[model samples]
Every structure is written in structure tokens, then in C-alpha cells.
Target: MQQEFLPQMSSATAFIDLSGLVNLFDFETKAAQAMSNLAYEYVVSGAADELTLRWNRQALDNLKLNQTVLTDVTKPDTRVTLFGHELLYPILIAPTAYHGIMHPEAELATARGASAASATYVVSSFTTTPLEKIADTATQPLWFQLYVRDDREFTKDLVQKAQALGFQALCVTVDTPVGGVRNREQRINFGLPADVVAPYMLAPGPQKNPLTWKDIEWLQSLVDIPVLVKGIMNPNDAELAIQAGVSGVIVSNHGGRNLDTVPATIEVLPYIAERINGRVPVLMDGGIRRGTDVVKAIALGAKAVLIGKPICYGLACAGAPGVARVLTILREELELAMILLGKASVPAIDRSVLWEKPDN
Candidate 1:
């Protein structure tokens, strides 16, 4: 019933195989080429030390989902619900801005794929399309990803706008207080608009101050939607997020873009999950290249998982269809894993299926 293009089982498609046919293309590399062709570099490169970014992917791949035996796997399922909203699959797209840099259709196409696939769309604060227009096109729910505006009033206004537009939740991206130190951008002297660009809130300048919990509280007070803290990795940070009255926590190291040499998101999920004690749902992103990776993440206690670079990769090659293709592979692969593992539903997966890494 789902429409897609899985490139024929040749050199390209064979690389990813059914194990991960959709992600066989390199959206990140293809995108870099497009950006370099378009003279856009500041937004994609990682900050100095770049080690953390590389590790996020490696750490995830290194984690093996210890497969289990013949329980009644006659009918497996992969549906998940988070923040009181149901997601057809546990994988959701991680918010990335400036989609126009990668595809002509950009965010509009992304919204279409996410909508069609029944996955949650976390609209970026710096999205190319206006929030209302994107929300208007959605066949599914929306989550507004917030980047604090110049002042409390301006930030409040953006939150109000998202709420009025019917975005179901607000995910506050906190790790990027100051933009990452991208030496590549410095080498080329690339920079964003010298002034403000957030169309939703006509605030001024590159925001100089970082938002604190007090500011987070202010945001929570202004909107009725549940607030989620994104870009957190450490368990200590997770504890603080719970106390802040936030509804969820997305454990991330900014896909290794923000801090260099931090723990891979996968390496940290268990500790964070243990700390939260299910008080709030824990979601994670970074280096999720396989369906088994999704299985490992939820089994380790991620309420759901998000994909960064991968969707962008698909966009570079095929626009909306590319993103849809990526999600399709992940969804099908997740279902197959569930079927093989005897899980009729996603929530039934747990630690019993995981094997402790000899290395970990």
C-alpha cells in the first residue's frame, strides 16, 4: 500500500541491502556537495574536535541487538505513542533547518513524507517554510522546535504562534547556546544573515544569551502544549529536565555537532533511562542507520528514536520521496525485526532481548 523506490539490488542498493536499503545513499555527503555548489557551508560542518559527531554513528552501529527465540511472533507491530500522541513507527525525523539547502521542495516535501507515513513532524525553529503553512499541510500532528528569540516577549510570541497554529508540542533545543565552533566555516568565512532570520518572531540579532531553566519555565507558562528538552545526553541533565516539569527528554549530543568527544547518545541512553525511572519518556538520536538500531534504542528505554542526516540524505537525491523512502525502509525493517523476535507490538520489547557488549 505504501509507494516507494528501493533502487534495484545492484551495487548501490546492495550496499545497504534489505537490512537498510533506504539509507544506502549518502544524503550528508550529497548535501555537502550541493551546499558547496551553492556556497552554503556554515550550517552543515561539525564544530572542532568533530570526534563526537563521528563517534555517535560508530557507537550506535557497535551496539548489537541480542536477538531472542521463538515466542509467538506470528504478528509483530511497531507502533509507538509519545507525549500522548501516537506515532506509526518509533522513528521520527530529527529537526534540521535550512532544508532548502538540500532540496528545492525542502521542508514542504519533508512534511508531506512525515504526514503520509504517520510519523511525528518536529518542525524546526529555523525552517524555510513558515510554521503555519507547514502545519496547514500536515496530515499528522506537529511539534514546534524552539530556538529562543531575542527576549522573553519575543520567545513568548513564537510559542503562542505555534500553539495557535495547532502544533501539539514544543521541543526546546538547548545544547546550542553558542553556535558550534565550525573551523570549516571559519576557513571559508561562512556566516548566517548578519541579523535575525526567525520569521515567526521578528526578534533581533543572533541570540546572544543562552536560555536557562527559568526561561524554560517562562516558555512552559506561556503555552498549553507539553514542553520537551532536546540535546541532553547525561543522566544528571535528565534528572533536571524531569524536575523542570517538562513532559519528555530527547537524549542527544546534537548528533555530535555541538560538543566534541562527548559520550555517544546510545552509550548514554541506558543511564539516562534508569535515572528518569519512566517519570518522563526518553527519546534519542544520532547514528541510527539500521532497523536493529531502532530495536536496540527502544529496548534500552528510548520511548522513540529520531533520525538526523539520513532524511536529509534522502532529500538530496529525491525530494519528498527520498525522505519517505528512508522512513519506509526503517519501518519495514523494524516490523521484520519484531516479527523475527516474536514481538506482536513495540512496547513488548525489553532488556531480555539485549546482550551486554563484551566491549562495553
Candidate 2:
């Protein structure tokens, strides 16, 4: 199957310009044409068997929405304030590694695009560009995603650099103790370029003592900015993050790239949100492609939704403009969803908008 796709890509030369694309799926199709086979799979594929990958979409599709009529929504507001920064919408660009694979501009283009859309960009630790450059280039809010190195001093230096550069928050990725078994990458023997490095990393792979709850506490102590722990799935873990002094929790399964067969981020979302019980903001990623998905997430108690693949697809298709278009489409979709559902503002969304599908 992979071989067939590669051959088809040989005739995929004429790039699909932004004007020709209408949705994320369209962008993804065009991107597949634009990128090399290995690069495309690395950005898009999930873990072994990809069951959780399929389930992430299935869970969102399984849920139903309850609409209200006869309520005034003359001016529906999609604005949100996250960690003291106000965003035009609740959609954030998820921190995916190696944007350079998709476009020449890489993280710089993404930062510019996100800033153009008035959205937040969570710059990945495994970035192709330097951290300070992205921070300096970004006009919108920037948050640094930390993958602590084996050396404690190196980790502290990275944290302090982010703080010094005016990064608003620290997003500690907690799931990747060791890299997951990405079967697609294995099949293609995918590896990073020799030039791409973490810049601050003192070692090659995951650190020896992969962060614990104590590490979370220690991370918080190192910086004055809000710290959000990403890669949480279980309610117990979410509770533990709060106890560890995290400012927020991102309920993700590493975009279905880690520990296959775990419940979809959407499947575990409400549970984690319920357990957190308003103690802190709960954001989620994985299988979020539509604006309605954003609305459903907020109704289920997500303060916002982080998007990964769509951003990749957008970059692949038309570079920075493609990414900005992706955000525009989703934002429009969310605002429309809100207005149609009689939600006047982000604060008006709640579980009341959700309908449980009847047991068969």
C-alpha cells in the first residue's frame, strides 16, 4: 500500500494552491502530494495497528449535540483567555516536531501563520529552528513545549531561556518516556536529519529518569510562568497533575502515536475534565478536525482544543497561508456552530449542549 502511494506521488507535481483547497481533508490530500512519502507518514501516521487513531475519530462521530432554538445569539463571541492571554478562538496549534519536513520555512512560518490568525503556538521541543528565533518571530502568544534532557542543568537552562524570551507558559510533554513504536516510520526507516537537534538537548533520546510527578513540581519551581502538563489520558493522572502544581492539563495520547489501543482523547476527555472538576483548565488534542469538534470539546469541558495534523496538512499544502487557512476554517466553523446552537459566547458552552446516544 505504501509503495502504491509513493508511485502515485511521482505524478503529484502540480501543487494545490490555497484557493483550490476548501477543507482540512482537501489540504491533507494536497499535502500528501507535496511531501515525500516518509515525511508525510511521519507527520500523519499513528502507532501500531492504529486502532486508537481510528477510534479518536469514531468517538467524536459517536457523540450527539443538543441544539437550542429561540435563544438570542445575535453576536456570538468565540474569544477565550488562556493563562492570561486572550485568543480570538479556543483553537491552538499543537506542538508537532520538525515542521521543516513540510515546508522550507518550518516553525517560523507556523509562528507567523498562528500569529496572523491570532492563535497561540505551542513550539515543540524537537523543533528544526532555534527556540529564541521562533519566540522573536511570533507576534501572538508563544508557549514552549519542554522535553527535559538527561542533564538537569541543561533542562534548567532551557526553561530559563523560555522565561527570558517572554514565553507565556511551559508545556511539559509527559507521555514520551521513550519513543512509541511508530510502525509506519519503521517500515520506511524514517529518521531525522543530522542537522535537526533540540539545541538544548544534552543527549540523543528520552532522558533516563523520565519526568515524574516530583519533576512536575520541580519544573514549576524553576519558572514563574504557568506550566501545563500535556499527554495525560486518565483521570488519575489528571488529578496527579493538579496536585503537582500544574496550571493546566492537556488530555492527549500523543495524537495516537503513543501506547496504541488507549481510549481516544475524546473518549477520555469528559472523564478527565470531570475528575479535574474545574480545578484547572483542561485542553485536549487528537482527532480534532472540524469546528463542530471544537464546540463539542468546549461543551464537554475543554477550555480549548489543540490541532496537530491539520496544521501539518496546511503547511504541506501552501506553507504559512495554508496553516492560516486551516485556523480560519475551524474558527469560522466553531463560531457558526455556537451561533446555531444559541451559544452567545465561549462561557455559555457547557454539558447541557451534549446529548447521550441511547444504548442499543
Model 1, 1-360: lDDT tens digits are: 234443223232233323333354455555465444333454446668788877877887776666667776765767787767777789988888767666666677788777767778888887877887888877778888888856767678788999999999999988877667677767886534433243553443456666788777878999999999998888888888888889999998887777788888889999999999999889999888778788888888998999867777776655665667778878877787777767778899897667775785
lDDT of 1 at 66: 65
Q: Cα lDDT of model 2 overall?
A: 0.84
On lDDT, the leading prediction is 2
| Model 2 spans with C-alpha error above 4 angstroms | 1-16, 194-198, 201-206, 357-360
Worst-scoring 10-residue span by lDDT in model 1:
8-17
lDDT of 2 at 175: 91
Q: Give the TM-score of candidate 1.
A: 0.87
Summed over model 1, clashes come to: 1
Report clash pairs, candidate 1: 27-313
